[model samples]
Target chain A: MSPVSTSASRLVYDALKSCGVRLMSALPETWLVHLIGLAEADPDMTLVRLAKEEEGVGISAGAHLAGVKSAMLMQNHGFLASINGIVSCAQLYRIPLLMLVSYRGEFGERDPWQTEGGGVTEDLLRALRIPFARLENPSHVSHRIAKAQTLAHSANKPVALLLCRDLMWEEQT
Target chain B: MRRLDALRAVYSQLEGRIVVTIMGAVAAELQSIGHRPNFFYLQHAMGLASSLGLGIALSRPDRQVVVFDGDGSVLMNLGGLTTLARYRPRNLVHVVFDNESLLSVGGFPTATSTGSDLAGIAAAAGVPRTQTVRSIDEFTHAFDEALAAEDLTTLVAKVEPVGPSAYVTDLSLLENRFQFQRYLKESRTTR
Candidate 1:
C-alpha cells in the first residue's frame, strides 16, 4: 500500500504558491524535511539551503525585499541564531517573513540537545514577540498557514508555524 | 564618480520605494544614507539579495522594490537569475554592482574573469530589460530610465573598485536588531 500523503505539506505548498512565495531558505532537519522535498519538486519554488541559520534569515529577508515571497525553514535551535537577521533586517524593514519551525524535543524526545531547543521554542518566539501557531492536524494546516502569511504580510513582521514531531510522526509507527 | 554618487542618483529618482541591500560595505553605505525601514541588509547572506528583493516585491505589489547587488554575490547564485526571470516582477529593479571581484570579503577574482557577461546572463535568464553602464553619468541616466520602465529590469553598473567608507557609523549587530524589532512594533501599533 502507498503511504498516506501528509496534507500538511500540501497545505504549506499551496499557501506558499497562492501567496506567490518563490524562494525558501532552509536547513536539513527531520521535522521539515518533507516541506523541503515539496519545495524542491515545485518548479515555482526555489529552495535555497544555507550554510548557517543566520544566513537563511538574511537570504529570506533579501528575497522578500526584491519582490519574491520567501520562507525561512529551520529548527527551533536555529531560530536563536536567526534572531538578529529577523529583527534587524526583516522586522526593521517591515519585510514579511514566514518561519516554518520544527518543535525539537516534544513528545519525550530522546535527544538531549533537541530537548533544550524544544523546551524554549515557544517562549523564545514569545520573547521575540512573533505570534505563532502550534500545528496539530493537517486539516488545520491550510488555514493556519494562510493566517500566518496574512499576518506577516499585513504587519510586515515575522510569524512562526511550529510543528511538533509527535503530531506529525506519532501515527506512522 | 563614487559608488555613493551612483546610489544617490538611483535613490533620488525613486520615490517611496523599498530598496534591499545585501550584506557588505554597500549595505552599510545605503543604510547610513537614510534608507527606509524597508531597507534589508543581508548582513551575512552574501548573494541572495535579488531573491529576497523578489519576495518582497511579489508580496507587496504596490511597492516598487530595488535590490542593490554585488557582482560576487550575484555569481554565487547565478541560478537565481532564472528564478527572477521566471517570475518577472514589474516593479523590480535589480541593480548589480559589478566590481569584477569580491571586494567585500577581500579582493577576489570572480567568474567574470573568464568572460562572464552578467548582463547577457540576466537576459538569458529572462529579465525583460538588461543594460550595462560603465560610468556614473551613464548609470544615472540608465537608473532613471529603468525606474520609468514597467518591466523586470537588470542594470549592471561596472563600478570602480572601492571599499567601505571610513566616516560611516557602525551600528552593533544587536543594536540594529533592536532597532528593527522596534520598527515592527511601532508599525504594527500604528496600523
Candidate 2:
C-alpha cells in the first residue's frame, strides 16, 4: 500500500474538519502560512486573526459557545500570554476547544529565541494543567491532531498539540 | 472586611453557582481557601476572566455565575465590560477587587489609582446595577442584593493590595485541565 499523503498543515486542517471545527483563530506564524492559505481558499472554513494569543483563546471560546467548534493556533512563546485566557475562560466555562502550538526551540534547533521555549514547553503545559502531545514527525501529525480533537470535543475542555520545530519548518518537496 | 473573607462567604453561601476567578492574587486567595472544584482560576491572564464567565452564565442560563476580577485585570480588557453589558447575561455577577495596582506581579499602580472608576465604567456601559463596597459586611450584603436583581451587576470591592498567601508552584496545569475536561463530560451526562 502507498504511504499516507500529508504535511503538518494538511494534518491540522483535515483533523479540524473531521472534528467539525468551524472557526479557527490564528496568528500569522510561518508554520501556518500554508494552513492559512488553505483556510483562505476553503469556503466552509472561517479563520479569525487575533492581535494577541490571549485574544485568540477568548475568540475561540466565544465562537465555540455560539454553536461552532473552534481552535486557536499560536506559537510556543504565545502560550505564556494565553495561559490565563485558557485557564480562566476555556477551562472555567468548559469550552471544548483545540489549540495548535508550534514548538519553537527543541534539542538540535538553531533559533536563539526558541531555545527557551523548547526548554520549558512541557513544564508550561504541566503548570497550566493542559494535556498536550508533541508531534515528532510529519507522518504522525494527522493522528496526533485527531487525538487532540478527540480530547477537546469529548472532554469539552481545551486540548493542545505541540508541533515540533523541525516538523513545522522542514520542507518536504 | 478582607477580600478573602468576602470570597469565602460568597463561595460558602452560594450553591450550584459557577464562579470564574480572574488571574492575579484573587485566584490564589480563592485556591488557598480550599479550592472548590467549580472555581476556575485564570492563573496569569488578566481581564478576559469576565468574558469567560459571561460564556458560562449564558451557556447555562439555569445556573448563577460569578466573576472575581481584579481592578488591573479588568482595565486590561475594559472593552469586555461594554460587550458584556450589550449581551447582558442576567445571572452574571461581576465582582472586581480594586486594589489599585498590579498586585500579583508587583505592587505597581494602575489607572484606577489615578481615578479610573471601573464600576462607573461598568454602569456607564449599561450594567443594570453597580456599587462600590469597602467592608466584608458590605460585600456580602451587596452581593446578595445584586444576585437577587434580575440584571447583570458589578461590585467594586475596595481592597488593599494583597501578597500571595500560597506560593504554590507545584500544582499540575495538565492535570487541572484534564480533570476539568472530565468534569465537563460528567456534567453533560447529568444534563
Candidate 3:
C-alpha cells in the first residue's frame, strides 16, 4: 500500500498521450493509484473506474471502434481476469488496445497469490498470442510504451507493457 | 409478449442510432429483422455487447448508443452495469431482452427465471434510470423516454421463452465492425 512515485505515473501518462490515447478504462492498482489520479485530472482523457479488467477490455475495444484510442491500466491478476474478453472481443475483432499491466509476481519475495500470476504471466500472454514488452528498468519506460502503442495501433492487436516489481513500488524486499 | 415481437418493436424506434446486440438468437433475430451498417452483431462474445456500446457512447457523446442484450448475457457480466452506472454516459441506452432462460443455449433457466429483478439490480448498481416493460405499449413509452433523455437508462423487456432462432447473417463479424465504424464516422461528418 506504499505510495509509488509520481514520476513513474507521469512518464507513463506522457507516453500514452503521445500515442493518442484519449480514453482510459482502468482497474486501479494500489501502487498505481496516482496514475489513475493523473488520468482522472487530465481533461483530455476520459477515465473510467472499471469494475473489472474484462470490462475495461470491452470498453476499450468499443472506444476503438468509434475511432477513439483507448488503454487499460491494471495489475497482473486483473490481466488474468481479462483473458476471455480480451481474446474474444479485442483479438477476434482486431482492435488495438494498449494494456499497461503492473507485474505483481515478477522478482523479489512476494505474496503467495501473486507468485502464480507472476510466474504464468508470460506464458498466458504467449498462449493468447499477444505481443508484449517487459519494462524492468525505469529508463525504458517512455520508448517501450510508445513502441507498444505503435505496434498495437498499427497491427490492431492488444499489446502489453509489463511494469515489473521495481518500477511499480519504490520499496522492494 | 414474444421475444421477436419485442425486438421488432424496439428496432423500429432505433432509427440511425448505433446498436450492439448480444450473441445467439437475439443477434440472429436482430439480423433477421433488418441489417444496418450502424448495428453491431457480436458473434462469440457472450456478455460484452453492453460494454462495447458503452465505450462507443462515451467516445462519441454526440451519437446515441443502444445495446440489445439478453438475460443470460446480462447475468454473465453484471459488473458491466456497475461500470455503466459509474461512468453514467448520457447517450447510452441499454435494453435487456429477458426471456429468463438461456434460449440461445437450449432454454436452461437463468437466475432471472427464478426471480432476479434486473431493473432493480441495475438501479442498485447506480444507473440513473431503470424500467421493466412487459407490454409493447409499455416498452414503446419507456424506450421513447429513454431515447429522448440525457440520463443513462436500462429497460428490461420480459418476453416468453421460445425455441432456437435460425436467422443466419450474410456478413462476417469483421465486415460488420468495419461498416459500423464507417457509419459512425459518417454520422460525425453529417452532424
Candidate 4:
C-alpha cells in the first residue's frame, strides 16, 4: 500500500543492503523521491541528504577510506556537477564509490535543461574511464547493483548504476 | 602572523591525533615540520581534505582527526561545512589558513581578500564553535581549545599570504595512505 513498497524501490534497497552499502548520500530528484524516503526509513543505512552532489562524492571517498562501503544517490544533472570532485578526489585517489544515478531527461522528459545532462550521462562516465551499467527494469536492479559494487571494490575506483526512466515511471492515472 | 609561524605553534600542541593536510603550503609546512605516518597529505584534491577527515573521524570515533586547510580549499567546497555540521563528529578539528589568496595557484586573490568571512560562514553553517584568529598567540590558544573540545570546531586564522619557501616534499602519497591505514588498523587490533 505504501509508495516505496513498489517493485523498483524494493529491488534497489535489497540490493544496496546485500552489497554492504552502509552509508548513502542523496539530493532530490522527482523520480527518486520515493527511493530516497525508503533509504531514510532504513535503520541499517546511514543516509545523508547533501546540498550538492560533489559533497556526497567527497564524503563517500572519506567514508570508503574509513572502512564503510558508501553510495551516492543523485540525479543525472547532479552527476555532471560532481565531475570535478569525482575525478580529482575519487578517481585520482582510487577511492571506491558506488553511484546510483537517476536517469533524467530521457525520451519523455518535460524539461529542456535535462536534455544535455541526460544525453551525455553515459558518455561522461565513459570519458572519465568509469565503468557503468544501465538499470532498465526490475530484474536488472540487483545484478547490476551487485556488479557495480564488485567493480568498485576490486578496481579501487568508482562505478555507476544508472536507473533508467522505464523502471521509475508509472501511470499518471 | 604568518602561516608557517602559526603551523609551528599549532604543530607543537598536536598529540594523539591523525592529521589530514590539503595541497600546497599547508601540506608543505606540515611536511617541513615533521613527517610521520599519522599525517595524511592529500594532493590535487582541493576542498576534500575536511570531507576525508570527516569520513575517518566517523569511522574511527576513538581517534581525533585534524585537517590543515586553506581559504581556497575551503571555499572550493563550503557545502562540506554543512555536511560537517550535519554529521557533527566530535573528534574533528578544521583549521583554515586564511591568507585571502589562492596562495598555491600563482597567488590569485580569492573572495577572502575582498571580504569573505569563513568563520562567520562556518558558524552560520551550524558548526558548534567557530573562531577567527589573527595572531600567533590567538591561533595557538584557539587551536588548543579546539583540540580539547568534544564537538566540531572550525578555526579561521587570518595571516599574510606568504610562503616563499613552499616546495615539493620527498614523501610518497601511496605510502602515506598505506601507513595511515595501517596505523589505524593496528590501533584497532591492539584495542
Chain B structural similarity (TM-score) per candidate: 0.86, 0.91, 0.95, 0.96
On a 0 to 1 TM-score scale, where does candidate 4 land against the true structure? 0.94
* Clashing residue pairs for model 3: none
DockQ of each: 0.18, 0.12, 0.80, 0.59
Q: List the per-model TM-score of the A chain.
A: 0.89, 0.88, 0.94, 0.93
lDDT of 2 at A128: 73
- Cα RMSD of all models vs. native, in order, equals 7.4, 8.0, 1.5, 2.0
Runs of candidate 4 exceeding 4 Å displacement: A1-5, B164-166
- Model 2 clash pairs? A84-B45, A126-B173, A127-B173, A128-B173, A129-B173, A129-B174, A130-B173, A130-B174
- The models' CA-based lDDT, in order, is 0.73, 0.73, 0.86, 0.84
Per-residue C-alpha lDDT of model 4 across residues A43-104, encoded as one tens digit per residue: 88888788788888777876776678888999989999899889888887788889989898
lDDT of 1: 0.73
User: Candidate 1 at residue B122, lDDT?
Assistant: 96
State how far residue B122 of model 3 sits from its true place (Å). Answer: 0.7
Best by lDDT: 3
Best by DockQ: 3
Candidate 2 lDDT over residue span B1-58, tens digit each: 5777777887775555666776656767777777665566656556777766765555
- Interface RMSD over true interface Cα atoms for each candidate: 6.7, 5.5, 0.9, 1.6
